[model samples]
Target: MKKLIWLVFACMLALPGYSQESATRGTANNVRQPNVIVVPYAKEGQDVRQLIENNPLVSRAVSKVKEEFGNRGFTTKDFVTLLKASKRNDIISATTGAKSDPVKDVVLESKADISVEVKIFVNKHANGSSEVSLELQAAEAISGESFANASYTSDKFITQDSLKLAERALGKVNDDFFTQLQNGFNEMMEKGRNLNVRIELGPNSGIDPYTEMKTGNDLETELQDWLSNNSYGGNYDINSSDMVIDISMKVPIYDQVSGKPYNVTKVRGPLISFLKGLLTSEEHEPKTKASSGQQIWIVIQ
Candidate 1:
């Protein structure tokens, strides 16, 4: 038994331990069905505190996340390999110094649904057991908005190597993390998909910004009504100058009628249809902005 205990200690020293932290979100629906990408990381100047991305501990932790989320129907993408090939690996070199330009650019270019930024740390105990911890944040690829965050420690009281320790740690809080992710996604849906809208009136367009519609409502009022009826919490921003109207809002990402996910073109489908009918001149279809999820620019001809 002495030899066995010594062996466990040796194993613990050779492998970094992992831990789990509490989650900060709740549950929701149809919001977390996005492709997942896990990015391993360490702190800016605290690289010694945690293993680097290439470390076995980091890789194992990434695997654990993939496995857990995968079992729940989320498709996992190998973002680390891509980052290496593109020399963007440095983007996640450390947690603090994460270079947004390359990392965000790569993320947007890949068109991934979500990015899981992960940092892991381990502490060895004198009692033949080790503690492994994980810090994770889930963000939308397009807007880089974090939807959920959690810190967790392993449930297994006695663990040896970093791989086993990390796996067991993640297992302990896997369900809670999943719930947090779903809740965040649902919240984003409730707040509306982030979008940029532009409405330009043609030189010959008959309707004036201040003119009243046949419904006894002015152009602004009609537009407002159309937007409110179709958006989350009826939220949006509008600015006008000359014949141009620019509106920015969080548009719904799911169809209330069909209960289906909304792509960029479909995000404002109802609103566009309504405006087209109201404005006889012409209205161009909504165009999605680059690196912006569901962000659209619309023009009135």
Candidate 2:
């Protein structure tokens, strides 16, 4: 039996044009128009503003990448437009800085499916040849998990136009990113998407997260159980304090109760209902926001 199993596995691996992966939930036939957001920076540790404002090369690089994504059928967002539209400066700061909090806030609000951060360095040698070095990383907006990374350098300087150079360099990296993106999306669908949950008690609410529940379990334990059971693989994180419970975890793409995949519009109702019953509080209101991808705020009174 062991030998037969091994033989089967080998044959499976050898099968031509066959794959074990499946499309992400809610995406049919591996065709989904994911919202793609592209942000360009000058280099590692440099603020994106430096590129967005000071460098023409960076602008060209960003535009090229955006165009490439558009050509590939992705619904792309204008990052510059987003920054300008956001009243919250923190989101803008986080986009250009190393701080992730603001980024998460923006992602949550925008609900983008894929976020791409690109860093470019363009050098013109004395021989009149230009070298464009690119470091590109693509992450799932919901989970903040990196799905693709590419570092490529343009060796042949076919054009003196920095814009053209930037475009060509990004093309190389984009190819690699798209190649890995499909598989990564499939894996994320299988594992589920991450959600950031914050639970708080109203000013007069008697609920205490650290207190014991009627089921012989503490509030934290009970909450954990509920979150885990609702999740795809019983996976979750809980940061419980005296007054608050913060949870970050993966929830199933499909809700067992509805037998349908979850999305921005459909997710909140089930979550709010489940949470209200679980807490058994007198008055509860849940707010679902798309930050980092999707965040839920539950307040009990």
Candidate 3:
């Protein structure tokens, strides 16, 4: 009887451990891993394409970081391929009289969830030894909010192979750096991604805050209702005046219907459609301006 009781007690103890292990596996499977892109850092007045093309060290460091991300099961995008495609689009936009922002265009086109900028520096000592330092900065692609950074300097070595030196420096902080980045992305997924929107009344616009819409609500109330319905979990902050409405809202990281990552373009279309419904005359229309990072601007005229 004592042996039987001991066996039952042992079974009870093992149950909790098994349950915990199952729960951990479930969480790991549920977490969505963000796609990442690594690019060489460019200073003011310096082009990123030029930097990557002319500097072998920068190119090598970028490749190393991208490979590390891939090894960790994260999907990585190629910056050079995206940059080349963006340049082709820029020429078409230039002829059409459309404005171009290269950095924003590349990031938006790539559709990478995170953009990492890499910078490398090397110093030579009189004793013929050289030390290499690498810096990595990561940000949410659409929001431009920085989430992770790492800076490491390698021990002095007689070999001048910058790639080897960079690998040594990166190896020291790889675990911690990736941990921070994944944590940041997980938090963003839970809380929803952020977007900033501004609505302005252009000159001669036929509507005002107090105007009654076809839905029997005032213009301001209609706009508020639209935002409340569209934002994720109805979460948003708004600042409004007679002529302008500025909103900072949280939207789902992925579209519920499509199960695909959301971008500014997806959000812009629906908003323009809603604004168009408020227009009572052909003379006034909803005009959408270009998006700047995470911010979108619309003028009703």
Candidate 4:
């Protein structure tokens, strides 16, 4: 009478049982995940000095950033409210600019990111000389202001710049003002494109030899052969450095009538723990149990 054969196999690795972990859950190697930093300008008020400051340009720039982030992630807005609360004149420029543009040529300068503000002045330089000077007032002292009209419109960057220049305003470039906005927006978009993450599958599990379970180089050779034959792509990477494999066994069953022999039982167990190191695609460790269930014996032709 031919004996029945039984086999078992499992692909799980054994891990040291520990209590539940807290929010900071990770292996020892995990120091910090990836992160990104973006700065956006939030609106404050719609006054004149505050007017251009809260202008559509600033608002639109910030809006573009949020749209770019989409579902991928979230951003922390660290606006430099310093401008809103502090002195209105040059002091705001000097302290925040890291003294880069000491002359205060920049109306809005961003560093790591501290503040967002807009400048409103009748430049005797851009507009080519204006008969009336409005001084540096944030309020609308005069109606139909050319500079004010130029800045908020779609073509405002150029229109406002021309009006400002016409008034002989030096160091103040209205066209350039919005240009920085464009630059900042571009920078935000560039960063969004660079963020990425990738993952790969490592080694597989297999059976082991008895007494002295198959280990070291001997196991690797056997594993490579099986993987190449069975895998579709016939491509894998095994970590040979300090490689350790899990071992198991297999039993064959044969039919007495046809005199044909084949595998029936494949018992596998003794999960593994990846405590030592990483596993690669080429690396495969033999399983511990492959033929040790109900019927471990069967006719082998």
Candidate 5:
């Protein structure tokens, strides 16, 4: 009888263990991976598109790095394709005398969560041997905050193939390189994304920071409260005065209402609704002056 009881107790304990492991596996499988874009690093006054097109070494390095990320199951964006589209847009805009920043346009249009810039260096010796090194820097796309950086150099080889050289250099640091990026990205996923907000009073609004709204709270206080309540985990910083209010906050990756990926446009709706309650007059209605990426600008007139 004692043996039977022992067996049942052991089975009960093992069942919970198996169930917990299954739940963990299910959660991990459901976790979404971030989209990444790889681009060649360019110095000031140097065009990245031109560099990648003209320099074989740079082109191969970019391709190899992107391949590594894609092989690891990351959704990778093709920088060359994006560059072509950006260049076409620039050509179109030139007729109207409009200037566009190509790098900024590509980065924003790609809608990538992270941007990785790659730099490659090569040295050739008189003995027909070559040495290659690469640097990888990853940053958050929306906020431009750098999170991971790694540098690796390969041993001298007789081959002149830049792709092979880059592959060797990357392979040396592959484990550590991805570990850093994964940790940084995981932290970002937990903490939410960065967003910047600017609020201003229009010239003829007849309102100031101290103006009381229907809620019986001053304009600044009301806006502050709204931001605090809306921001992820109530995380935000504010700089306020009579002229303007600047707020930096963290927003969730997914919209609470739609459960879809969130962006500046999605955040603008709730903010406009809140502002409408404060500025009832049509003339004093809130208008969004800018809504792009992680930035939102509103003016109450």
Candidate 6:
């Protein structure tokens, strides 16, 4: 008995899935899925603690980000961790959900820095010679790291006066940042991932598996269906680029009297049902609450 138990334990340790697992980041509860983080950018060593306490735009953006991301499998604590860990300049390096460091073949930067510039002339004296051009810029209460080291400048003038100009610039930057962030996330979707597939036919027994046909002029619809079914990732004309496999099959039996092989007979059991219903059993009927052994019926007079 002890020897059998030892054998079972050894089998578990030797199995690849049981012993080794792929690494994924950002998942809390030690579960499967990716995580998201939001960071802010503020002036270097700028006194903005009181500003956060008072500002509304900053608070609104933070709240929306939390609400939106949390609904997409993110937690406040996870977002905070991501905010703390993620670099302000690297919003596109997101690794959350089913993939880890899933960003392959491309790089993304989701951070936006709204920089507004106010250019104005100040006259210290009535004389025309006493003129000075001043440029001032500011960012509102932002906690995300994307704001840090942001490379942006505005040529639009907020106003002619220095104080008013600076204020206008700040407003423009905040508005631009918010708009950019919203648009960036709204259009976000994962790219079509690739899955390798191959079909090999065993020697046909009763089904003969001998008849074959070739497809000519494969069009857009054909290519799309093939790619979708086979999990192909590349995009091109089916007629020009990726095409389906052309098969040739020979008839199995020969006519005894004619001394020639017989024409192929095709089976019509919906092979092109084509490995369907993989994602769900929607094509299949759901289980009904029927008793296996008995049936009840009422008779009316």
Top TM-score hit: 5
* Prediction 6 global C-alpha lDDT: 0.28
In candidate 1 the C-alpha lDDT for residue 267 amounts to 48
Off by more than 4 A, model 6: 1-31, 34-39, 78-301
Clashing pairs in 2: 107-292, 108-290, 108-291, 108-292, 109-290
Q: Which residue segments of model 2 deviate by more than 4 Å?
A: 1-35, 42-54, 70-112, 123-131, 155-168, 201-207, 252-293
Candidates in order, TM-scores: namely 0.52, 0.61, 0.74, 0.19, 0.76, 0.21
User: What ranking emerges by TM-score with the best candidate at the front?
Assistant: 5, 3, 2, 1, 6, 4
What TM value does model 6 have? 0.21
The residue-level lDDT of candidate 2 at 36 comes to: 80
lDDT (C-alpha) at residue 298 in model 3: 90
lDDT tens per residue, model 1, 1-301: 9999999878765552211110111111233477778766534443321343548777777767767788888888776666555644444343455544445554655556678887877888888778889888998766667888888887446657777778767777557888888778767754655677666665656655666655777777788877776555678887777787777766555555554444556545666677666653444433333323545555554
> What are the lDDT figures for the candidates, one per model?
0.64, 0.66, 0.78, 0.27, 0.77, 0.28
Predicted structure 1: lDDT: 0.64
Model 4: which ten-residue window has the lowest total lDDT? 137-146
Identify the superior model by lDDT, candidate 4 or candidate 5.
5
Per residue, candidate 6 scores C-alpha lDDT tens digits across 49-90 of 332345443433344444544555443332223333554322
Ranking by lDDT: 3, 5, 2, 1, 6, 4
9-95: candidate 4 lDDT, tens digit per residue: 121112222212311121211121112122222222222234325554433333333333232343323233434444545423334
- Model 2 has an lDDT value of 0.66
Candidate 5 Cα outliers beyond 4 Å, as residue runs: 1-30, 43-45, 85-87, 91-100, 121-133, 154-168, 256-260
Over all chains combined, what TM-score does candidate 1 have? 0.52
For model 1, the stretches where C-alpha displacement exceeds 4 angstroms are 1-32, 42-53, 87-99, 123-130, 155-164, 195-233, 237-248, 254-301
lDDT string for model 3 (126-229, tens) is 99999999989988888877889999999999987877887788777668899999998877765677799988887588677768888889877887888888
lDDT of 5 by residue, 1-301 (tens): 9999999988986763345543432322224677899988765445666788888878888888899898889999998887776646552122233454455567768888788988988878899999888889998776777789998888899988866787688777586777788778767655677899998987688888888888888888897899888887678888888778898998766554554557777678999988897775877888899887778999887
Better of 2 and 5 by TM-score: 5
Candidate number with the higher TM-score (1 or 2) = 2
> Candidate 4: which stretches are off by over 4 Å?
1-37, 40-54, 80-91, 95-301
Model 3, CA-based lDDT: 0.78
Q: Candidate 2 residues 1-301, lDDT tens each?
A: 9999999988886664234432223332233446788876433344444447778877777777888888888788888776667887555554445555654555556657777777888787888788889877888876668887878787768467777777777668555577687667667756777877777766666777866555767778777777666665677888977677888878654443453445543445666665565554445444443332367776665
